[model samples]
Target: MSSTTSRRTNPVDIIVALIGAAMFGLVLYLRSIEVSWYPVLLLVAAYLVFAYLFFRRQGGFGGVANPKDFYTGIVLLAVCGVFAAGMFDLPLGRVARPGVAFFPLMLLVLLFIFAVAILLSGLRNRGEALGPVPWRGLFIITGITVFFGATIKGLGFVPAIFVTGFVSCLASQKWTALSATTTAIVLTIFSWLIFIWGLGLPIALCGSWLRTALVALGVAGESIPFCY
Candidate 1:
């Protein structure tokens, strides 16, 4: 092999490998402070595995021939790393009963497996060139998420989901005002029935803020819609 032969390392893979290395270092530092968690061990093992792959030039780290799978793998690997870290805070209970993070951790594991499979495919099969990102859809979805989170408590689930559904429908650029409004109404009603009536969950239809604002404008409690 010529010394001048350029290595075709994927930038995405390099980024992921670097992240894993950083995480490994962080976990070690955490352990130094007595934050010895189970996920920390798993993450250490994961980091070592990636470091092995990265150095050996296996799993597309040698050269990413399939950019699409490489990038998708990077995204999923990032997701798994983030959520897996969060699992450190939750207790992994026994078989008779599961902790809050048990199911989520299991799901993350499954996601990680899938991500690994997708990554391995890059070593054999070549995928089509990646397309331009759907910025419009991404922006709309991100805005919707932010709105839902910000308003779910203050605006209440009913109005928040309704507005979310409504805006979501309109985001397609094909939904008319009437169509979006109708879909929002149906979505809101069905969700309310399933979550509130059927499950008997303690989600409020309207929040106290709405009632206070309405009352400030001279609307009585009896006149407020679903605020009682």
Candidate 2:
């Protein structure tokens, strides 16, 4: 493809890669500082990068000056500014709860704000500048996420993540053995941090279970006592 055609086909890929790298770095830094919700930030960056790349490759989100993009950007800007204002310097500590209602309330307001923004943009543009979202891969990915979240505790996080990654990648019809294995490893590490370390949740690794069994057998053998 010519440069222009390539640009038209995938203008957002570079942005997506950069965003992914930056977010990965951000989470690493945040974890080093013992910050809460680092995984949530990583999740947001993942979804954002995916959405941008997905839409651009499908058809550019109706071009650079697209109203939908502008509206989305505006709503995001408002969310940052308004939610911060609402959450900051509050006297909610004086109340019985001793904590601000800001976080939950901000989410509700932010959702409404985004809905309104999209509605207004659609109304103003009359769907002229916006294309239908490219959702072929998205639906499969969503299902994988749902399945992973629902089964992780019961199946073990590592196993659940491995299945999720393989299925998600395969759904894109772009999977090789190496890609599937790489995805599984990356997601397993992510699950270990987010569920095991960050949340203090017990999520056993399938490999670790085998290791435990071997250790138990070794200990049983060592009960001969003089070997200690």
Best by lDDT: 1
Q: Give each model a TM-score.
A: 0.50, 0.34
The candidate maximizing TM-score is 1
| C-alpha root-mean-square deviation, each candidate | 10.3, 16.4
Which residue pairs overlap in candidate 1's backbone? Answer: none
Error of 2 at 95 (Å): 18
TM-score of 2: 0.34
What is each predicted model's overall lDDT from 0 to 1? Answer: 0.67, 0.53
Per-residue C-alpha lDDT of model 1 across residues 146-191, encoded as one tens digit per residue: 9988877787878898999988885685879999999999999999
The parts of candidate 2 lying over 4 Å away from their true place are 1-127, 171-173, 185-201, 206-228
Local error of candidate 1 at 198, Å? 3.9
Query: Candidate 2's residue-wise lDDT over 67-146, tens digit each?
Result: 55356656676776676566545533312233454244335334533443342233223223445764867888888999
Query: After TM-score superposition, what is the CA distance of residue 176 in candidate 1 from its true location, in Å?
Result: 1.2
